[model samples]
Target: MTDLKFGGYQGDKSVHTRGGRVLAEALAKETDGALTLAFDESIVSRGHKAADLLSMTESGELDGCYFSSSYLAKRVPELGLFDQHFAVPDRRRAYVLLDGTLGYRLREEVAKATGYEVLGYWDNGLRHITSAVSIKSLADCDGLKLRTLANEDHQRVFRALGFDPQAIDVRDLPEAVKTGRVDAQENPLTNTLNFGIHETHRHILLTRHLLGVALVLFNAERLATLDPDQRAGLQRAVDHATQAQRRFAEGDDAICSTELTAQGVEITELDADTRAAFVAAAKPEVEITRQNFSAELRDLFDKELSAA
Candidate 1:
């Protein structure tokens, strides 16, 4: 039994922290306190940003972490497909894809690349664009300086939709918006409220863009040192915690929308035609993204997209 340090970028109130708590509780209950866990909030002791946590985990600096898939996509380009605007129809489809062979392939690739075990994926939910001005149509996104993840495909996809995308880290988003360095940004409803993105800018367009995924990963080498029963307990803990996190994210959309509106944030849900316009504008980029994906990833993407 070692002192295991687990952490993520979000504060204690976030689903990330809740998920950590859930895992910790599960481990304790299942393993009988065989492993001790110290959950670090906002990477306070790790001294690394969320995006870099996976690498830190691999290097054994941090035993494990929870972070956005989009940030991890920089290391695994195949993951960028999920970041493509409208790539996933809904959260259900996203889960189907992530729980199937596609998810297994991604886990394998990530493990190989970073030496970390892809334990589970929790929902980040659908992302939407929010700005200083209301965005009612695709044209509204044009020429706007939008903040996007450092992933190249994110920048490319936004560019295809006529946005001037700046690759900014999520931690730096508030400052970017406050300083007027970027006029708009996109994230899940829960993320907007959790990070106070709604406070700086009042306009929120319910684009339901990317249904993002946040991965839970652990150091494979470190995990190997665990006893057999401890390993089983850890797996069970991840599964239980991931399910809880997904439930929180799915339920947050409505609650967060209500809170944002109560805070005077102008929220707009795009109509059929408006959504179609965005899809049309971004279609070429989607196709290009598909082309860029490896054959294995493309096959899986085609399967998921073609499924009823």
Candidate 2:
């Protein structure tokens, strides 16, 4: 009978928002009308940023939140393993790795490190580079000042690729691009359009370099207070919501190129050799990540991903 507050930073049209709605609706049905839930889209309205959401959950001001795993990796370095470039090439393989043993183990590790339980991993889709300049080959990236996530793994990969990377908050990225503070940045197509980065950056490459996941996390302590039936119902709601969001993400990827092109953004589909070159440039960072993070989990991730 307790009311649950779920918060998301994504706007109304985003899958993150849709997923939260699905979770709340399913939880209501599964709990047989015993639970009340309130959903807030863009907690930034309350002066809460994405990074602050985790701390808010830990302090019990927020019951749950959804954000990129890389944001969480900032606090728990081991989670950075997922941020490695070209880690999951396609959508199908991404599900294999995340829904399999590797993801379960990593979730446990994350839970121990942070006081949040991973309910599910929602697909953020594959991230591609968007720049003020067209990138037709690997050479085009030279000396580019790219905006990137503040996560070390992301910055390290961009640095290795012969570009200068500046970490900028998503909220500030539009001005960052307009002011020439950064020449380029990377994100999923949906994010580029949603955040209005596509308007400022005309050239978008289909590098498909990184696949990101938005983790739906609930405070472990809060979840533990639910009765067994309620807990099971809540978990099921997350699973169902995740599946729906994944479908939305996949569809968005298919539609984005046409949409961006219509808006005057030049879209380049990377040739196989060009993509391979960027991958090779980024490969060295993987070993560094493994060495610096949880080797056991990274090794298992490699073993499982390779097998698939």
Candidate 3:
């Protein structure tokens, strides 16, 4: 029997870790104990940055991990498609595209580019802005120091929306929020609450600016060493985990929102005009970024987006 290692940045209660647990059980069952999984629920607790997971997996320090697609965008430019603000209207539409042709092509591209096999797309939730002060209009964002992922496309979109965006790794985010290092930060409500950002930032702006996705990745070389049955069983395990993770992610938003409200955090839902203004303000940046994508990728994105 072989035991493979999987790592995650989030705490054990997070959907990412929960999914990892599910994958471990399913893989053992599918492989009939020929293959097993050992999950490290919070690698961040082991003094590693969340962004470090990518290189760790690629270098085979970790056999597998689930990480945000934004971090991989710089290396795999095709992934920048997911970094576009407001491009995916909601989680349902986003999943349709991800589970379809666009996702398959990107998986191939990612494997070719980075030598990591893409196993599944796990929901990272719809990102929203949480601030020390309420953000009601575009003007409210001007000069605001915002914490964002280390993705240039995301930085550009936030900059166009009038925010002064800074890249901060997920490991350092809670202290950054507590110490007022940034005036605002964006994440799903689950993260805001889980990471304790909601405790310090009293206001939650339902920007829903981006629907985040975490790609389940396995080291390709390690996968290639597996027997055919083991490889097929691994894929089946990933499929089971993906379905459960999506359901957990979908339910988390509502639960997190209610918990935030009970904690006296103010939740702001933007009116139509306000939301439209944000989309319009960020449009030029989105268009410019889209131009950098390959014609093939752009065509695929357009087709999948329309069909979704």
Candidate 4:
């Protein structure tokens, strides 16, 4: 049995469980119960946290996990570089860049640096502003208490945009919003609904602020030890699971739009004028993100993805 341990909020049925379960079941069925899974449920659980899980999987303590890309920013700024401010529109466009240019380079980097194997790619889609108030433009962001991942760049971007960002653990956000400690926050549809944010927010402004991607990684050494047949079986399971991940994320995007609106949330798209201002505010930050990208890799990436 392939032992797999993943991290996510216990109740989260979005990407972590949604995608992880597909792989777990596939492996188990393929191995005829000779494989097993052990999912690690922890919040404050970020992508960088998976490094140890990958190591342990190599050492036989675990198998693999659905690791977040945002959390890796602290250790290797380049990993989180793509998540920098500004919007990428939708998941489809985001994937073209992520799975295209960024995804290829990132996997090579992680494998070389951390001995982790990137199993598959799954982009969770763009983030939106869900709040107690209607936020139509950049001007509306001023003076609002916004919730964000307690990461250096995330807080910096929101503060630069003129919002007073409260760097609290995400588990406390709903309570924080309920108590009026924060008026608005940013998160993707998959996570927002998984966390039940719709119950407390009245509006969800369509601001493709940031996109999230989870990298399913495995311990490199362990993967290498598998016989050719087992390795093929594993890759086959992941290939099938990749399609499941795409389906789950895309389906939930539609579900989130409908569910939140049905629950009385005001869902509106930002007008052209507001969108322009918002893009202007986020441009320099995003440029900085692009500039910080590895110079040599960026050129290769640009050339490779353009071909793809």
Candidate 5:
């Protein structure tokens, strides 16, 4: 039996990490126990940092890893750009993009760009802003150092809105806030709850920044070396994990607003006018990404999403 060393973020055993657990169990069953998974160590703890996890996987030092869009973008720039447009403010449309044409096209682009495969697309739900203060308009971002990940899209969006985006690593966020290195951050409600960010921040601006995230990944030649049956088993495992994680993320996202409120994290709902201002600031970046991708592919994605 071959043991697969799976690594994940230490986010309170949330659905994201638990999804990996499901994958391992599924693979264990499908492989008739030939493949087992063990995960305790994280790529973050190994000096690769969150942004470098996928690159470590490519180097064959790590067997498998789960990453947010920001973390995955370290090695794949175009996919990171996808994080911007993929966030169309509609959770259902975001789901349409993933699982539909958006998922397939972006996966192909990632594979071609990184020389790796996108094993599966899973939901992370939507993202919201956690600030110490309220945000009523785009101007509210001025001079605010918002903590974002290494995601180009996130930085670009904040930049477009005229703010100083502090690209902080996830692990360092708590200290960054305490030290006043950043004023706010954009993260999912699940993350706020799981990572205890809600304890530090007071405002959660509902932006629904993309439908959570779709993981772009592969472990270099590992999957390529698997026999056909092994490959199918592994694929099934990834898919099953995706399904479980999506369900978990969706429910958690719904509960997040209430959960945060209970924790004293004020939920700030942007009115239509203010939301329109944000859309105005962000839409150009989305259109610019259109040229970065193929028109045919983008159009195909639109069709698939519409069909849904």
Candidate 6:
């Protein structure tokens, strides 16, 4: 029997960890116990940062992990295609593009450029802003210290939207929010609540500026050493987990919102005019960032986006 290790940064109850658990069970069943998986659901509990999962998996310290695509944009610029603000309008459209040709091409690129093989794309959720104070317009963002992923494109778009963007790792965010190190942060309601960000940040602004996706990654060299049947079993496990994870993510927004409101968190939905103003304010930065992507990648994204 082959025993594999999987790691994630979120708590055991989070969608990411739940998906990892699913993968482990499915892999064992598919392989008829020829393969087994042990999941370390929260590596942060062991004193590792969330961003460290990428290198850990690359170095084979972990057999696999699910990490946000934004973290790899610098290494695989094609992934920055997903980093574009307002490009993915909603969860349905985001999945259409990700489950289609665009996702296949990007997966190939990631394998070619890095030490990992992409197994599946999990919905990271549609992100929204949670602030210490109310934010209803673009002006409300001016000079506010906003915490964002460590992606240049994300930082650029937030900066253009009048925010003072700072990149903070997931492990440090709760303390940062509590200590007022950041005036605001953006995440899906699931993450905001699960990470305890909502406890400190009283206002939840429905910005929906970006739809996030996490890549299910396995060490490429280790994967190559697996027999054909083992590889097929692993793929099947990932597929099953991906579908289940998306379903959990889809329903979690409403559940999280209800729980937040019960806890007295102020939920603000942006009116049409306010949302449009944000889109308009972010347009120039989006265009400028797109110019930096390879023409082939941009063309692929454009074709896929239109079809979506």
Could you say which candidate leads in TM-score?
Answer: 3
List residue ranges in candidate 4 displaced over 4 A. Answer: 10-12, 30-34, 40-62, 87-89, 98-102, 221-225, 300-308
Assess candidate 2 and give its lDDT: 0.84
The count of backbone overlaps in candidate 1 is 0
Per-candidate RMSD, Å: 1.8, 1.5, 0.8, 3.6, 2.3, 1.0
* Candidates ranked by TM-score: 3, 6, 2, 1, 5, 4
Give the number of the best model, judged by lDDT: 3
**C-alpha lDDT of residue 69 in model 5:** 61
lDDT of each: 0.82, 0.84, 0.92, 0.70, 0.72, 0.91
Candidate 4 Cα deviation (angstroms), residue 9:
2.7
Q: Write the per-residue lDDT of candidate 1 for residues 1-308, one digit (tens) a residue.
A: 66788878876667778888888888787778888678877763345556667677879988998877887776787877687777688788788888888888989888876778888988877888989888887888889999987777778888988899998867777778888899999887877888888888789988887888888888999989988988888888888998888887777788998899899999988899998888888888877777767997888777886782
Clashes of each: 0, 0, 0, 5, 1, 0
For candidate 1, what is the TM-score? Answer: 0.94
Model 1 whole-model lDDT (C-alpha atoms)? 0.82
In model 1, which runs have C-alpha deviations exceeding 4 angstroms?
Answer: 44-48
lDDT of 4: 0.70
| 1 against 4, candidate with superior lDDT | 1
lDDT of 4 by residue, 140-258 (tens): 88999998875667776777677888876665776787788888888877667767777787888888777777777787877887777777777677767777888887788888888
Candidate 5: stretches off by over 4 Å? 45-48, 70-81, 85-89
Residue pair clashes in candidate 1: none
TM-scores, one per candidate: 0.94, 0.95, 0.98, 0.84, 0.90, 0.98
Better of 3 and 4 by lDDT: 3
Which residue pairs in model 4 clash with each other? 1-34, 1-35, 2-35, 5-38, 6-40
Comparing 2 with 5 on lDDT, the higher-scoring candidate is: 2
